[model samples]
Target: MPGRMERMRAERRASGEASFFYREVAFNADAVKVMPGEYFVHSEDLVITTTLGSCIAACLWDRQAAVGGINHFMLPGDGASDDGGRYGSCAMELLINALIKRGATRRTLEAKVFGGAALIAGNGALNVGQRNTSFVLDYLRTEEIPLVSQDVLGPYPRKVCFFPKTGRAMVRRLPPAQREAAIALDQDARRRASASAAGSIDLF
Candidate 1:
């Protein structure tokens, strides 16, 4: 028998299937990993997913243009990898660039950011959630992209759905334990990326 929290999480995951625009965007690891330094874009529709631990996602919308995009990244990429700038710097740029491509600019854009949850129970040394949140806020400030809303930094994982057409972002909090598991998965991904990079450098 599952506990109350477990049952609740199961319920939420099940409910997600009922959404009309529930598109499963894959990340890293397995066939479903959104790497630490990547971005994805889509038009005005509900983009929904679950996240835990230290990973963070940002959602951008342009009201006048009825266009928007979302990005899920781990660390703030330093522009060294093939990803160009997949982390926060790249993530922000990707979303903005997509919007610009669609006729939206910083002067006309509205943004809403989510995730960056600290789901673990212990005083973990890897507070990627906090770091991610800080990086995003700083980036937005530096770029002058005007953030209209945000839901970040908590003890719970989150389910975020953003409607680009309407510029509305919906967020639901996940249980604490569930968030911890998500964090564990995130750490494992970092380990894998590190090992892969080490192997590549040796080959060079």
Candidate 2:
């Protein structure tokens, strides 16, 4: 059965449907690496991936519309400026609006959230992770979106891969070394959250 599916997928790929999910080779499939304050949306099976430590990533799917999107935000709320995806509010709005424009209905949206880790404890720094987790949960609740799944508020970082069309996700806790790198990236993203560099909008 697996071999037969592989042959079918190969034929699909050969015919130029480049984004179908193939489990065995999925790690090497064409992918979009979403940065902090970035998002990706698709009505197909393209992979959207991100790494997070203290930030949050939200994956939203409209079951009826069969479309989904994922966003990564550096901060919990708007920070003096509304120009970037770094704020969860802005990031969430962007993804929701995009999905709606693409024929998804807000009434059918469901959500899965990830990330928000306390990497550096007791540093007098803002507990950004907890804040991010709280903010997103509240936002979704207020918007009436059902929270179906989540893995948040841990001591480790995570790498998330989301399949938009199927609304399936895989999350792996990073190893210690890569966890440290994710912490570094999270700190950098927070520091530069107010900057004007455009965050990405990827289809795959």
Which 10-residue span in candidate 2 carries the lowest summed lDDT? 12-21
Clashing pairs in 1: 27-32, 27-33, 27-34, 28-33, 28-34, 85-90
lDDT, candidate 2, equals 0.78
Per-residue CA lDDT of model 2 for 1-204, tens digit only, reads: 555336544652211112333343556554657788777677865677888998899999988888988889987776545456778898898889878987898889999999989898774346788889999999999999999999998788998898888899899898887867777788788767745543432100
What are the runs in model 1 whose C-alpha is more than 4 Å off? Answer: 1-36, 46-50, 77-79, 84-86, 121-126, 192-204
On the 0 to 100 scale, the lDDT of residue 183 in model 1 is 68
Model 1 Cα lDDT, one tens digit per residue, 56-168: 77877777888876667666444345444335676677668867888787887777888776665454545667777999888888778788888888777777655566676
Q: List residue ranges in candidate 2 displaced over 4 A.
A: 1-28, 195-204
True-vs-predicted CA distance for residue 93, candidate 1, Å: 1.0
Highest lDDT among the candidates is held by which one? 2
